[model samples]
Target: MDYRIPRGTYDILPENSGKWQYVKDVFRRVAESFGYFEITTPVFEMAELFERSSGENSDVVQKEMYRFMDQKGRSFALRPEGTAPVVRAYVENHMDKSGSRNKLYYMGPMFRYDRPQAGRYRQFYQYGIEFIGSNHPYYDAEVIAIEMAYLKALGLQNVRLEINSVGCASCAKEYDLALQDYYRQFLPELCPDCQKRYETKPRRLLDCKVKTCQVFRTDAPSQLDYLDEDCREHFTQVRAYLDASGIKYLVNPAIVRGLDYYTNTAFELIVDALGAQKSIAGGGRYNALISQIGGKDTPAIGFAGGFERLLLALEKESIPLPGITLPKVYCIAIGDEAQMSMLPILSKLRQSGIYADYNPDKTSFKAQMKAADSSRAEFAIILGEDELKQGDFILKNLMTSEQERLSAEDLLQRLTQ
Candidate 1:
């Protein structure tokens, strides 16, 4: 039988797991530093949770969702993104009953069925946060800053923050019509996806990556020009807060993002190291999403970044990340008798909190020593027939090449200290 991992998924082997840990640790630290606590939701939820939060016409629900009917004929979906699931959890738990602001962060794998690329996968890990209960523009800037701080901590030197405002639902209604009207003239020239979006979600036409669609969108209306007074004011304040924090940014009006829930403030963190798929992180304010998903009318804003892509960017920049710590001592047992005798000493060292390991294979002295060197142990202990009989062992400092005879008790004490 031919069996292998499903396409679009990869494993994190021991040799490279350290880099993942380092990036996750940095994200946790930065999130907590901003007064956010961690929250975890189930990996799968009722399909409608996403369908409603991300509009039914949006690409997430229309094309990329991994949804299926269970044995009971109930529709469920592997979470396509993080925000909708977080919002669903908030509503189900009635978190608003506390009357305190809910500042939560989540880090986990998100599933989306799409054409896999360098920085994207069907099952990929993401680090994101949700700030529910505040519509303040400062939170928008703060959310963006948290993402920026995390990337900077990971040693990304060239990161571009491109921000925009897509207006509120009220203003967007008119903008949507404007888009429909503008693109309707090019119906014959538009892609099939754009043609479908023309009637369902004309705003999406502006974000199409196709060459013909992009060229056709050159004269499309800008959402910034249509922002209502309140939306415009909110964007202005967000920029002011970012300026006061000394975070440099660009006001890019074309960045509508790939979701239907965003309103007013939208931003993306871009870096050229990844070529065409340069967006390392992005999100915006989704004030209407909670109410749309049957939650209280709470305002929320958040962002998510791919851990694999961030690590790739760090690698491209030649940045060093933390790795697993090597064993402190490698114990060598030369003969069958010595191998059995060395077990107790090895146990004692480990029980005392010293990282110690010995070869289970009873190999020759030379082969065991080579294994010790390859294990990257700082010290090597040899237990031979003579040493086992004498109640002493030879401890060799792998780095300094210093050797000394030490009793079992002495060896334990030396290694512990």
Candidate 2:
């Protein structure tokens, strides 16, 4: 029987996983530096949580969700996005009672049944944060700053920050009505998806990437024009904070993000290096989400970027990520007696914070040295019957081809230094 990796999933082999680790480390450092803590939820959750939080019309809920009924007749879904699951956890755990803002971040794999493409997958990794319990616009700016700072730290190039206000509930309602009236005339011209969105989610019509849809959406109503005074001011303050921090950005009117819960201050970090799916990171304020998912009214916002896409962007831009380091020492044991002696020294070297490895097989001397070289060790310690009796070993500097006789304690000291 021939088996293959599932359609939209890919493995992170040892050679490539280092870049992923580097990105995660950089993100974790930036997030913690800004006082954000980490939060992790299960890969699967009750399907209702996502359905309710993402809304019926959003693409995540309507399509791409990996929904299934378990043996107990309970429906569950692999998380297609990060924010909804995080919000569900916050509500179920009663995190709102803490009376302080919850600045939590996460990095993990998210499952979505997306059409597998160059930078997308069925099971892809995302790094994200959720800023909960704060209605302050500065929090919006801070969240944006965190994402921007993270990308900059990665040394990514030609990236752009596009900001927009999808408006508060009140103004968005008016904008929806306006969109309905305007698009109602051109419904015949829109794609079937946009045609449905005209009734279900009018804002998404402007976000459509269809060629035919774009033709009719040229003069589509801007959400900025309909922003209420409070919403307008909130967006202005977010931009001000970005400017003050010297984080360059553009105010894009067409950026109605792909979720129903978003309100005021939507932004995406775009990189042209990765073709049409240019969004490296994106998120915004969702003040009504807490209450919508059965919690007390709490304001929140956050952003997430796909790791597969992130690594792709970095590669396309020719940015260097931290590489995996080689073991500091490889111990070569020539005979059975030497092998037994080498084992304890290997453990001791590691215990003392030196990365060390050894070949356990009964191999020839030439084969053992070849193994040591293959292990990429900076130095090789050769233990033979003679050296085992002499109370010292031959330490060869793999890089310089220099050799010196050293006791076990001396070898550990030299390598650790």
What TM-score, computed on C-alpha atoms, does each candidate reach?
0.94, 0.96
Task: Compose the digit string of candidate 1's lDDT tens values, residues 208-244.
Answer: 8889889976788888888889999999999999999
Number of backbone collisions per candidate = 0, 0
* Candidate 2 error regions (>4 Å): 99-101
lDDT of 2 by residue, 85-153 (tens): 898888888787766448899989999988988888899999998999888888988999998889889
Each candidate's lDDT (Cα)? 0.88, 0.87
**Per-residue lDDT value at 208 in model 1:** 85
